[model samples]
Target: MSPLLRSPLAGSGPDLCYPLLLNTSCRLSLGPRFSASLLYILTFSLALLTVLLNLLLIVSISHFRQLHTPTNMVLLSLAGSDLLIGLVVMPLGAQYYISSCWFLGPWLCSAFYMLSYVLTSASVASILLISLDRYLAVCQPLRYASEVTMGRVQLAVGLCWSCAVVYNGGLLGVNMRGPPRRTSCQGECVVVVDGSSDWLDFLVTFLAPISTVVALYLQVFAAALSQARKMRSSWAAAAVGAAAAARRSELKAARRLGVVVVVFLLCYFPSLGFMGEDVSVNSAASFWSTFLLHLNSCLNPLLYALFYPWFRWTIRLIVTLQILKPNSSRATVLH
Candidate 1:
């Protein structure tokens, strides 16, 4: 949904805060054969897949006791945020995409759009916090135990949620009333990312958080290497020093985190780049690129399972149980 076209419906008269809707309607007038059905199918399928995988991810993590840690709790919160996004935002976005219009009434439309933005913001913030936490653990392991407390994590999550609420909700108050028009037609409201708001969103949503993540990961990697060197120096003093093993694990974790950083950077920055430009030549490019940005949330659990051994073990246990479903009862009876 480019801001250029205010509304899909043409000849729509403005109601109370209806100018935006009319503008959207006017912009939505179609030209050629865009397969709404196919788009709906893909959109629905992605939404369903994202929901199912994220649900399984959350359930698996919750059920596995070994997976419980302050770090995993942050991941759990991330999963919850992504789950909300998949459940609430994706399907509705798909509907709007297919219909090329917002028929879901004005209030509902505004609320849905706002919620999508809020959840997305929260998810991004949570990811940044996770990176920060991991950096602390690897770089400052001794201090990490004290600093990254469960209470602190809870506070971080709360702050992320509050920031998302204020930022996204604030948009609702800054209404984007459309041009004065006389014709009456179906209407809806969408966030207007014009000159200032667009840059503001890019700064808050992508730039600042990305910078935080990059800096944290950089420090974490340097710290991990430093720790590794320190551990190697003491290898001769103690037989079977677990410090070396711990350093190895920390290095591996840092590498996995590097993947996350790369994914976040690759997925998100381009869209911001496009949006920040003056000319809207690549609006479709921006849309698809931003869509892929959301897809990052769905991809992370799988990446964790693949790259982190502990996560892999948890995933293996969950999958084994799922595969042995029919024999689960038999195993229970034998026990």
Candidate 2:
């Protein structure tokens, strides 16, 4: 018997397949729950859409040689991490969310949980790396090529995955295996940290990453400001206008990265805050709070679709050609 199973909030996990709404506090059974049904639909749709978008991104990135660079290699790693969460973790989560209990065996349950944690952590780290890359390119253009070489980028990616595995794995040890727990049906389910480790989890997982990202961007912004000041001093010079324009573009790129940082915090922080509150931590809010976290899996694809112009254009080109392609009727018409 696990700690969660013995807790007062034992029925807190959203029952995905059972289709019954029982208030964790009141035990008032609401007839035929729709929340689980909605969650199921949302989880399935988001995961499927992400898979398609990531696959298209992979193919497009592969086919276009010009898109192959150290920076893109980091992007590719981020896409890969998103794809892992969408494909591997989302299905299990959807099943658990819908069923209300983890039907998957203990090994698989642990594996899925671990996989989601690792991939998500890696995704955050990768975003941090991307910010650093953009910073170097804009702030230190002359040395950027030599500094952010392919070998160094690959090492950074390797470090990202390694850190993700170790850090999140530690949490998995605490959450999944640390305490024994059972589901509403009295079977082995995931261990829920009702109150303990909540702040620690928030700091290590979300706050630390966010702080690092912000710090990197701050350095980038400062560097850009310095360049702008230099350009202003040389305003009468022939190349000053070009230099200013280039600096402005770099600032714009930094702003784009700032958007990424903002989105990540927005999508993740609510859940952290919800978990932070004692009352909410053990309520339906805890179960429903994960929806925001799950939304993180779907964000990368949307971000790329919206921000990466080349990727968008490539997708459009492929769609247009596919739509315009003639079927068997074209052969008959020619004859």
Candidate 3:
């Protein structure tokens, strides 16, 4: 929920965002003071958990030589965005919800929203790449490695981040150009967008990438089902040693990552469902939708821990500091 005040509860606060601003200030907006405190603690705890989990994922992927493949490269990229969401967005979001106030004030508020948009776009891009990689690996195993090389994956990640930055910068250009309108209550960083911009963002950031990801994963799922019934299916490509083994591995990864993609779509669809509607930020739908989106930032690492044996093993090694020993980067993670 936005740190914005509803008219009914406008009179309930001795605790205000900016007490010094008096009449103009937004109030710290929850029903009971104790509930607000509990909520803050809960939200912050989740954010911290998100940071730690994603950090582990980042360290595991970055520090391990054996983990450095096109698939892991894309994973590493996704983890980076997730880490930032935990580090930056989640805390800010928590404050926005608990206190219902933009404590950072005017310009930082715009930057904060812009950062969120960039991360959101970048995350969708990362998922799209992952889905594409899985599609190729499952649907066309013979061409997977050649098409999704490390160099190409890295280039794609760079391009995705760069484009996200540019796209969101332009998307929130009105706020980027100047402070939020003064008519807003103090401590409120309300960003009002025209219907045109709303539709544009919905299409670009939500519809297009999400649709592509779903479509690709559909193919991946189909190929997986076919391969499941027949190990010697055309999609799995019978070959000796590494080639065949690699195909099997790729097929497994596709299934695991499919879970990740499904969760992404589920979290996103609600949050972006009413893009054109000027919904009250304080509404239950608004609150739950925003909560779910932030919750998604933490879900991926949890999914990795649950699905990937390599990830669980690496976490143990890293936690035990076994990774500090000589030639540790060469240690086997994938079982």
Determine the backbone clash count of candidate 2.
8
Candidate 3 segments exceeding 4 Å error: 1-14, 232-245
lDDT at 61 for candidate 3? 95
* RMSD to the hidden true structure, all candidates: 6.2, 7.5, 3.1
TM-score order of candidates, top first: 3, 1, 2
Evaluated against the true structure, the overall lDDT of model 3 is 0.79
Sort order, lDDT high to low: 3, 2, 1
Q: What local lDDT score does residue 23 receive in model 1, on the 0 to 100 scale?
A: 43
Q: How high is the CA lDDT of each candidate model?
A: 0.63, 0.64, 0.79
lDDT of 2 by residue, 236-304 (tens): 435667766776776776777667667766766655545444432353554445556656657866787
Tens digit of per-residue lDDT, candidate 1, span 191-233: 4455677677777887788789888888887876676566675
Tens-digit lDDT track for model 3 on 81-181?
98998899878866775565787878887777778888888998999999998888878876875777899999999999999999888878953469865
Between prediction 1 and prediction 3, the one with superior lDDT is 3
Supply candidate 3's per-residue lDDT for 280.
Answer: 50
List of clashing residue pairs for candidate 2: 2-180, 2-181, 16-97, 16-98, 16-99, 16-100, 17-98, 17-99
TM-score of each: 0.77, 0.76, 0.90
Candidate 1, after superposition: displacement of residue 160 in Å?
1.1
lDDT over C-alpha atoms for residue 253 of model 3: 85
- Where is model 2 more than 4 Å wrong at Cα? 1-35, 174-188, 193-201, 224-237, 241-246, 274-283, 317-335
